[model samples]
Target: MSVGWIRPVSGLAASQIVMDDRIAQAEAPPGLYRLDRNWHCDRIWLQVRNVLGIPAPRVYGWSSSTDNPVRAEYILMERSGGVELGKIWHDMPWEERLEVIRTLVGYEKAFVSANLPMHGSLYYAKDLPSPSPSQFLDSVNSIDKGETFVVGPTTNRAFFDQGRGSVEVNRGPWPSLNEFVHSRAARELACIDKFSSYPGQQGLFSGPNQYHPTRALKVEVLGDYLKVATQILPTDANLSKPTLWHSDLHSDNIFVDPSQPTRILNIIDWQAVNVSPLFLQARHPSLIEFEGPIPEGFEPIILPDGFDDMSEETQHQAKNLRAAQSLYKLYEILILRRCPEIAHALHFRDTLPGQITGLASSIFSDGEPILKGMLIQLQDEWATCVRSSIPCPLSFTPEDRTQQKRLEASWSEGVELMHEILTEVGAYQGWDGWVNHNNYPVYKERLARCRENFLDRYAKTEEERSQWIQAWPFEDKTHSPTSL
Candidate 1:
């Protein structure tokens, strides 16, 4: 049996613990343990613990360089053992859940108190990524495979300058929060065109296609829409100060006392924590999100004055419903009063996706009408709260309406033709793994030749024939433009 090392003050043990491949446990004296893992700036986890003073495992020492054998490219720290908060989220009573939310809110408040002078990921100043454009883009690309457009997990300070028309205006670790917001929105706009050009996003049902119609009219117009939207955002001095935030605050990252759900033992996985806009950081802890639609109109859930008379289930449901809403409201109230620039920018930007969907509804039948209705609500909110003086740019002109109606007709015809072709080709059977197969390159080459041949026989240009190819449902196909 392994012996436990105890600290006289806290009475916690250093015992064998299992973590993922990125980290491993060490056999050492009690009160001190080593994390044997590859070294990276993600070790900023220790810095976070030190700064926030959350009741996390204490780090005695760390080796951020692979060369250090004693520091072992890892941290020596006290161990924390507790039930994972996620495992008990559903089982905890409403009162317990409420307490947890309050604890988390306090944690967030502490996080905001530590002001960083720039917008970027947390890293030792010496260890920060070089401020080169290629290095910066590569860093953003490294965060995840599927999501390429979002800015994150990069330490390059110069990567945040978004001027206009270009993806990056200046290489900057932004000095003010206002410029960071401007740059972030500008970067998003620049990504729209780049996202469209991605080969993986070339198909009709590709991620970009799902976002906006592939045609130029919808794409170009939305870029204009984004510029107008960004102009109305807040750029106040207080709002521009950067603060640290845990961007991904899912339940698994938290561990709590098994007996008292309200007590957090530790919070881990601080790899990508950012020092950026508070609006970008605030969100309800994911563990407590209500299962159904997020309620609208922002009414605070008023608990009745009657004392503790409700049944357990009713109380639990009420708490669950109100928790996310209350947190959202709290964050909004703080931003509105203290950082109105961010409040206006973040809230207004949230509605853009729904508006984009409304503008590009011809691509998918799923929830288009609902999205359209939501867009109306978002526009009204934007007008009332963001810019009551300026005419809402999102309001459709008569020409805009006519243009979309015409696009809808053509889109309907195209989709009908696509379905007919897919059915004729028998694509619905025999392949359940088109997306995951490793031999996609071999398959893709054959597909290119097929499309080339089709265009040669019946279409004037590859661009025209490519539309039909985009609509093809199978990884296997040789049909030409004439078939359509």
Candidate 2:
């Protein structure tokens, strides 16, 4: 098992044993070439827990080698003491929920205020290939035992994906935020040169519309992103400061007391931490993310005019949504009061440079159509894209815009199909024509039926039906756009 229970040193908390068993994973790297730095990934993250007052499970003991009796690199932690936030959240009164939101935002304020010297993951000084104990001894606060944590090469998977894992790329404790972004862009550029031909990301969307996504299109869009990176990156010292952030802060990770509902005991799953500039790191936490109307700045949210006329169920859903939106606005308001730079960075997503940098970060996964659409929109709204005298660097012809429209439509269908796969087919972990032994026969039969039904209902002609069958996602010879 990748996870297990452990005995905590303290009687006040439970224990959680998380093990990064490389040998157990189906896709672990070859032992001969796997970097030693990677073995410390799960353990080194906790270095900040004590310094930042982040109430996560403490790492009692850990190892990066598999020579021990257990034959694995494992992390033992003091598990959180309280119940999951999901258990008591929806059932609580409005005041209790607000308190929870306030507590969560308070912790975030601490995170944003921490201005570190570089962008990278935390590692012990001695664990590095060439120990530099004297250099980064002050990166994070020292442990009580005199052990030091150092800022080292980032363990972010993006730098390693698509066969770039062991290759010499600038995965770094980047001295500047701009350098971090440049290195990421450069890595993606290198991948494009190696694997240029990728089909449009249109898998699993059971739809008839199809459009070709090209490497040329990706290059054109990424070039504009590069222009933003090099020339228009925010120069404000506050925005450029390398900060540590927890990327996945959801309700499930947060634990609260069942007796005193407002008390948050601890938060779990801090493994997806990242060290990037504040502009890229600021985002609404998953707990407070809402689909309802959100106002500009710290504006107050008002109930809709027809709330009294709506159905009971609709009104209930609307009230819940409004509460969630209030939580979102409250988070911004709290940041504005405590750390205004981070608050400003929160709204930076709407600006031209922000959009470019934001979209560029996920370009490899987001693919062609979305990037092309952003470029076209920016070009069309040139006057508003940039507030200054600098003209927009991108221009596309009408024909290019028209093709982008088709690609967008196809991409939307693919997205909807992916949702269906997640909720309906239970492909939540991502399916690549594979299923567990117990479900293998059942999935195979269901897939055959789905193929026939899709072809019969959606295919325009005999040739189209044949092509659709050949391109089906859950079968032999499945295609992956980002596969190395």
Q: What do the candidate models score in CA lDDT, each in turn?
A: 0.48, 0.64
Best by TM-score: 2
Model 1 clash pairs?
5-30, 157-172, 157-173, 158-171, 158-172, 158-173, 177-240
Superposed Cα deviation of residue 480, candidate 1 (Å)? 28
Question: Which portions of model 1 show Cα errors greater than 4 Å?
Answer: 1-44, 56-80, 128-171, 185-212, 215-219, 235-240, 293-397, 404-484
User: Model 2: number of clashes?
Assistant: 1
Candidate 1, run of 10 with poorest lDDT: 7-16
> Which 10 consecutive positions of candidate 2 have the poorest summed lDDT?
9-18
Q: Which lDDT tens digits does candidate 2 get at residues 1-484? A: 3222222211111111112233233232222111122445444445546666767665545557777545665555555687988887789998888788777777877786664658887776766777454336354665542356666788776666434453466988787776888888877666665664432243453334554445676676777677656555675778767777777677887888899988988777665465678888877788777676676656677777899999999898888877887877777777788778777787676686677777776555456677778767767776665545776767688898898888788877777765655454443242233455456577667766666766677678987887776556564443333444
Q: After superposition, which runs of candidate 2 have C-alpha atoms over 4 Å from their true positions? A: 1-45, 66-72, 131-146, 161-168, 196-209, 296-299, 377-403, 416-452, 475-484
